[model samples]
Target: MRREQPSTQEAADDRTDALRTEATSSIVGYRLRRAQLSVFQRFLTVFESLALRPVEYTVLVLIADNPGRKQTEIAEVLGVKRANFVPLVHGLEQRGLVERVPSDFDKRANALHLTQEGEAFLAHARQVHEDMEQELVARLGGEKARKTLIELLDRLT
Candidate 1:
């Protein structure tokens, strides 16, 4: 039987080729959407267990803390378009978690207020939101990780 032997440089060349292939595979464009969606999915898991979406949670908290805030102001703070937020506000109203009272300053505008029921719901939502924040930090690591990611996101936006 005859045994075939491979040269050392041939093996070295093979290794270099493999390295180049792997490097090419690694060099790709930003996977921002993939990473963003992953974060959102984790958020959804925590939010779904509660009875509110993240947006609703935010809205509830804002209303809870800033009673008599105008809907337009809330939309501004959230950086959401007023047109888009109208339906979200309506949904909260339908759930009886919030009420829209006519603004004393502007007859055409409405000021938002958390009713007694809304306050109760907001309290529970706050607890859930806090728990979710903890879990998010845990998954993403400590403050540094979150801050770094937030900075990167701000740049992208």
Candidate 2:
């Protein structure tokens, strides 16, 4: 007698189980990272529609709030390397969203400022982001969602 082939659904279910077993067998940290990526994937879907990277959005939001922030200070607040920010700053400059000016505190350092366009863009992008957050995480609502996510991320760090 010949053995019958497995059904498609059974094969797919077996594959999923195998993958899950493999995923769970690895280090706990790897599983944690995988879960974080899954959650943030949804977040990227929302933010990507704005046509701005999260780092770029953070820079614009920071500059809008802290007018005349020095490049060093901006890098420090965002925990990004000072040199790495040069390209992002240059891009913002090219887009007419930001301006670099002589620093009042230090002759060698340049201060950052958001141009009119940057401010307007930040405001709109932030509002859209908030709406998306609400839509995706209505269970946590506004403040609770942020607080919960922050708490969870803090524990990971």
Candidate 2 Cα lDDT to native: 0.82
TM-score of model number 1: 0.70
Tens-digit per-residue lDDT, 66-95, candidate 1: 988899999999999988899999999998
Off by over 4 Å in 2: 1-18, 22-28, 139-146
* Alpha-carbon RMSD, each predicted model: 8.4, 4.6
The lDDT per prediction is 0.82, 0.82
**What digit string (tens of lDDT, one per residue) describes model 2 on residues 24-135?**
6587777768756865776678778677777887899898889997999999989999789988899999988899999999979999998888888888988977776676
Clashing pairs in 1: none
Question: Cα deviation in Å at residue 137, candidate 2?
Answer: 3.1
Could you tell me the TM-score of candidate 2? 0.74
Off by over 4 Å in 1: 1-30, 151-157
Q: TM-score of every model?
A: 0.70, 0.74
